[model samples]
Target: MESAARNISFKEKANKALGIVPEDAIISKSYLFVSFIALLVGGVLGLLQGLNRAGLLELPLWFNYYQVLTAHGILLILVFTAFFTIGYFYAVLSHTLDGLLPKVRKMAWIGFGLKIFGFVLAVIPIIMNEASVMFTFYPPLAAHPVFYIGLVFIVVGVWMCAFGSFIQVANWRKRNKGEHVPILSYFATGVFVLLFFGSVPVAIEVFMIIPWALGWVETINVMLSRTLFWAFGHTLVNIWYLTAISAWYVVVPKVIGGRRFSDTLTRLVIIMLVVLNIPGGFHHQIVDPGITESVKFLHVFMSLAIGFPSLMTAYAMFSVFEKTAKKKGGKGVFAWFKKLPWGDVRFLAPMIAMIAFIPGGAGGIAQSTNQLNQVAHNTMWVVGHFHLTLGTTAVLTFFGISYWLVPFISKRVLTPAINKLGVIQTIFWTVGMIFMAGAMHWVGLLGSPRRTSYTTYSDHATALGWDPYLFFLAIGGTLLMIGIIIQVYAVIHLMFFAPKGETEFPIAEVEENATKTPYWTERWGVIIVIMLLVIAMGYVIPLVEMIVNAPPGSPPYSPW
Candidate 1:
């Protein structure tokens, strides 16, 4: 038995030394390839929408503005982020946990197929201009029944991948009993847990909508649907965030020649985020009328509670930076920042992402306030907020990950030229987002509305005032298009044409003499139960009110 154990241990070490197993690499590569494809297509759609909104481009009636808008939101916010998160985490699981089990691998491929098939089904309607209800797809603004059906498949696909991660992690723990899961893998576990639970509300929402959309039900509860959608919507936003920060904690440290922050602190942040995340959705509905003022206030507190974990993250990251710089013999407070790598694309991109979030997070808190939300709700300000958070913070981090992750999975090296191109791409993206998002916020404060096509309102003075800012939006979109082209080229070259060599999956280690993390942190089952309880506490009352004391339902409307 001891010899058997020894041999197993040897095999696991060999697997690590040899890098990602070939079979597992294919799964990550496939997901990544599809994700970047979505980015390319979605990025194009984004530029078109930007131009149209700026009154610079007039789309043909065959493919109108709303269709483009809906598709853009779905492709980037839903498809691009979802695919990249799954792909990245799968690679993390394989690298840190030795390798994926065969069944889990099979499930991943199955999930990929389902998602692709579903995306195709959903896109057909968008192309036909039958599903212009936007990504939110809330009731009364119904899409084709097929669109909701497609969403069901996408949700199931996500669940499959989530469950596969669970199986992979559970198997690893059983094999290495009493040992803490590697930090990167631990982050992956939290991400997949959020993916599974976060998507549940959306799934339920979609199922309810399909019948109303098909006319089996004459009318639908609009507020209830919006409530359900936000439950998933807000969580989905954080799922991308958690994916971004997993790298912030694990990969960024190694790229910068630093050790990770305290292991116990890191795990605590993850637990706090998972437990407190779902309830924060209520803030999205603060402006909507169905829920009571006291309920919204309670939810405002819940939303603020989520920010605590983000603050913890901010603290942990800077500490790593200062400590690492001091070890390298840096002087003074701010001088340590200069000692850090500013040229490496892997570092440069995520660093900018973190910087963008300072304002992005602040904007989110402002929007959660009752009075402040009433000001920005359904305005260009809201659009600018997400653009900053998701477009800059989350998307740029994904770009940073791709520089290393693409080469690592492809068994190739990131060439100096490609890295240079990535740096330029990051610069373009940052400047573009700043101009566009900044203009959006300014115009929104000037009372500009969102979700409308270009209009001068018969050249009214207030409407004319927005044109200057809208022109800035066009300029930013043009720059971002250039960024996308360069980024896509870099990804393709790295995947297929870059010189063959080994690339290590860069996961940072804890500092020497670090304290051991408690085993209780590994009790995800209990953590999940607590998360569910908190979710129930947050949603039960409001959801009950929305349903039981409900207003008259509205029938489907197809304004388009």
Candidate 2:
């Protein structure tokens, strides 16, 4: 009892010293502020696209559908996710591992500036209609040279932050010799490691595209660029997944008054994710021509391999929920579910996110399969899959995190009113995604194409048949926009206007009886090397084959 008291006292002191360090808080706040602003802009643009797709709104010439589409994709997918992940994890680093190092903080600020500037530069071309290549920025559809240059800067900025995270983690290890990294910081480490390494292929792709975009090069290797992009593209998707799951594994347990499921299992999941992630990108290209059958199968296997960790995560989370509920004197399997805090926005939003992933992940696996992909690739089904996985599964969880995170950093508390508003926001987002994504999936199966403006193909029967589903898609987008408004408002209020008080940076403790995690999990160097080997195994042969037998390069075509 004395020892326990002493430990508690030390923690109190440590938290007092570390509580919402002004400088560290500012870094995360700035990132989050930008994140929400991007969401606002992108959400509006999404509404425009949805309306256009439904044939409800014909956009002006200056702001056409493709331009809106491109901007919407980049803002939400690239800007919002990137900034929020960095911001949230930086806070994770600060809270879990004491305050951020001064140098690390400086690096983060510099990275922030670079990313913002880069985004501005990229946006300019899109506004001028000089770049509407969409987020994938696929090579035969090149944008202005300046756009690619801007992406280079963004990539560099992300690298700066990634390295800063590395420095912070390393510094902590040096000071605390034989300790495991705090669970949240360990998650940050995995995310940043991915940010740095995953961006490499995209960086190379952009460099190759710049000269081609500038007309200095006559032609670009379309297939090669695509292969490289997906290498980064799918990994970027997983980066967001890893971030959301961090909250699930660490924050959710604490919010519900339970210990984390298992430290070793958790750590192992991170390791498995890092090692197996990059090659899974190939599954995105399974339907693309030029890849050999054997290589395609390899990628399919790798992609499915990535899902295994998610299943493990699912099992762990369910176990935690059941155990916690039973501890609350709830009896029976189904009845315990009723005991959870459904009214708490922090839990409600993320719990819904977890539930949404069931169908989202199922769709993803279906898309990964060769035959199924042939039907869905480049269709509205693909669009629905993206939104379901990223928009609802990842973005909703981010929303949940913001409820407490913004307050925690801003030295405020999440008020009851805002929490209730958040629950409403969660409902709006959930219903919106189902309407939009479900319609997209159904219409896509009915043979409606994506990446095009609404038209009846001169009033053709099949095209006219898609109208009802597209209208539902519009309704979903409208609801989602409403959700975005409430969410952004909640964030703003939590950041600046809520009653001044301390909000806990919730990181759950490991269960008392859990087995010790192997120290080998700490060998990030070995893990990264293995990640590299897996990536090379998945890429080298197929990449070599693509390069050696490549078709003649294609000149840039700005269809917009």
Candidate 3:
């Protein structure tokens, strides 16, 4: 078997292999640049937020703790992750759609403009402490009207990006009759569809809240607000998870020298995710008043349904991994793991992230289980667990994608040193998260609350005991900052200094292409209809009761 890589420069391989042209690369680079900037800012806020919780780093008179917390959550989870997903998937779908139409490209740019403008509008108020409602915006504690309006623009931006893909896919399907959607595009379409579905409730919430924040409405229903927020919130995280799943099916296999696990099964899981994703948000409000136990139980059951798709993918990942290793001349069951491409940042980042999900999934189970939610509610345990899922699983996978993605977009090559830097960054990140997650989980069991400065209670004996764990948190947080800073430097280096060159994308080998793919795979209209029907069955009864027999809205609470 002669090497396919032989006699091929990276530039030649990329040019020959990828469907992208210079224009496509340029558009993606714009999104990547802003995403990195947001990550750097959010990364700093995260470090400070952690240290503040540990009773270190007193803020300047200009800054308030709650505002920083709000900014941290909003920027990283919403801006950074969302923009990256939009950008990454655009690139993925563009190839399959035979290059995005010029109008679609224009719409995406317009969307990006709104996102940046919206971020500017919102973040200024946050910096000045005028909008410190926290990311959940649990109302009665209202933000400046600008905050809601800014967020609305962000949502609109997301919609524009999403619909752009929809138009491209619909157009492609129209021109090429009876064609099976390519595998990556299939998953990307699923992400966009669910995102559109998730945004509706959020849009309505923002509409109601903005007027309330401006004093048009005398009161805001805190419970109702929280309920609506989570409706789309869980789906947002699921969208992030689905984007990673796309990598798992397509990119991961290629980077690790394996073919995709199973095309039909992968398509089925993507469909299952879309149909089952929404409506589980009710479980987040298990302890809130007015929602009945029966309804909560129903939500818990539906929330648990999400695990089915995840478990199915888990089976496929393990199978593909083991089979790939066996083909590489490895023997025995566990021994096959050694054949994976550990040194490649593309593989390492997501691998660590997937490993982190095991613990994150456990945390989710703890938080979602109606009974277990009591033990872990509002504790650092939940906070620690949430970090594992998004911070590690999603963010780390994004990091892996960034390694090659930025260079490919910028027409630059990653030097050997930068590649080595990514590996080291992953190590620092994994170790640091272990320390933080371990400390938080331990202290949470001791009844330490999340989102508080425990230093304020240092005079008490129980509070004094938290110092060691707090110390661990500070150490872990500092290391995490180092990891983020290294990546920030890596991104900047590639953007500005790395030598000009083209880079190749790792498009995974397909296992087999049966002459005919399942036609149901392309029947997205039917699937979405079924999803709406299932979701209505779960939500209508609970939500109708809350609206029809409404509680008096809660009076506003302004702490500052």
How far is each candidate from the true structure, as Cα RMSD in Å?
2.2, 1.3, 3.4
Model 3 residue 250 CA deviation (Å) reads 0.6
- Of 2 and 3, the candidate ranking higher by TM-score: 2
Q: State TM-scores per candidate.
A: 0.97, 0.98, 0.95
In candidate 3 the C-alpha lDDT for residue 133 amounts to: 80
Across 382-418, the per-residue lDDT of candidate 3 in tens digits comes to: 7788778988988898888888778876778888899
Model 3 TM-score relative to the real fold: 0.95
Model 1 alpha-carbon drift over 4 Å, by segment = 1-17
Q: How much is the lDDT of residue 420 in candidate 2?
A: 96
Error of 2 at 329 (Å): 1.7
lDDT of 3 at 440: 85
Q: What lDDT does each candidate get?
A: 0.92, 0.93, 0.83
Ranking, TM-score, top scorer first: 2, 1, 3
lDDT of 2 by residue, 345-417 (tens): 9999999999999999999999988899999988899999989999999999999999999999998888899
Worst 10 residues of 3 by lDDT: 1-10
Full-model lDDT, candidate 2: 0.93
451: Cα error in model 2, Å: 0.9
Clashing pairs in 2: none
